[model samples]
Target: GGRGGLAALRDTWQPGPGPLAEAQAILADAGLPGRPKVWRNRLTQGNLQLRYGRDARWYRFTRSGTEWRMDGPPSASPVDLAY
Candidate 1:
């Protein structure tokens, strides 16, 4: 991502899915604890908050996460990993 430091990490952050229900499925299958919440975001076409606890609304999936592509190992979307 063009951004660096924490911004870069935030930009590349990717979770399971955008929808709350779908994201719950991903987290459940992976034995992870989190939830996805939708918010009105002008910066991004949409925003999904994936996390639990007080910071539950902080976790998000950025554009870089979607752009990620790999041919080696078992690289898959968070949703794919859940299954």
Candidate 2:
């Protein structure tokens, strides 16, 4: 329902080591290696998407065609949702 959310965030999103970068680093530290396409607080690699919540947690999402659906519960560590 909120496909444009990321785009809307672009104006306020800064280019630096924030949640997106932290999540990437977490995955790498956990030995799950792969760089995802990032935009603001969201990252996408293949059909999997990782979104950072305002609550300082990470949420996993899976894509089906053009829609992205939440796959499971949120985690404080991105590594927990790396799978």
Candidate 3:
């Protein structure tokens, strides 16, 4: 019931489709091709990935082989990450 417990709970919790739909809309508006696959807070399309941060920012990632690594800093808009 302390900080550790809260962290564990946050880790296990999955955000609903609101974030995912918002990201999709943003990408679509930006004219990005294809749709991203959602898992937890991440959206992956091809080698590009975007993660919704707890800080209300979208983070960019790139897939290298089987691992996805952070590619840049976080932004308040998913459009920035999509580009």
lDDT ranking, best first: 3, 2, 1
The best candidate in terms of lDDT: 3
How do the residues 1-83 of candidate 1 rate in per-residue lDDT, one tens digit apiece? 12222342333334344444444555555544444333321012222333211222323333346552221222123354232
Q: Mind sharing the TM-score for model 2?
A: 0.68
Worst 10 residues of 3 by lDDT: 1-10
lDDT of 2 by residue, 1-83 (tens): 13333332232344456677877766655544455778777777767787776556667778889988778777778888888
For candidate 3, write residues 1-83 as lDDT tens digits.
Answer: 23432332244336678877899777666656677678787777778877776655677777899876777666778877787
TM-score of each: 0.24, 0.68, 0.72
Query: On a 0 to 1 TM-score scale, where does candidate 1 land against the true structure?
Result: 0.24
Winner by lDDT between candidate 3 and candidate 2: 3
TM-score-wise, the better of 1 and 2 is 2
Worst-scoring 10-residue span by lDDT in model 1: 68-77
Model 3, C-alpha of 1: deviation from truth (Å): 28
The true-structure Cα RMSD of candidate 1 reads: 12.0
Model 3's TM-score against the true structure = 0.72
- Model 2, poorest ten-residue lDDT window? 1-10
Model 2: lDDT equals: 0.67
The lDDT of each candidate is 0.33, 0.67, 0.69
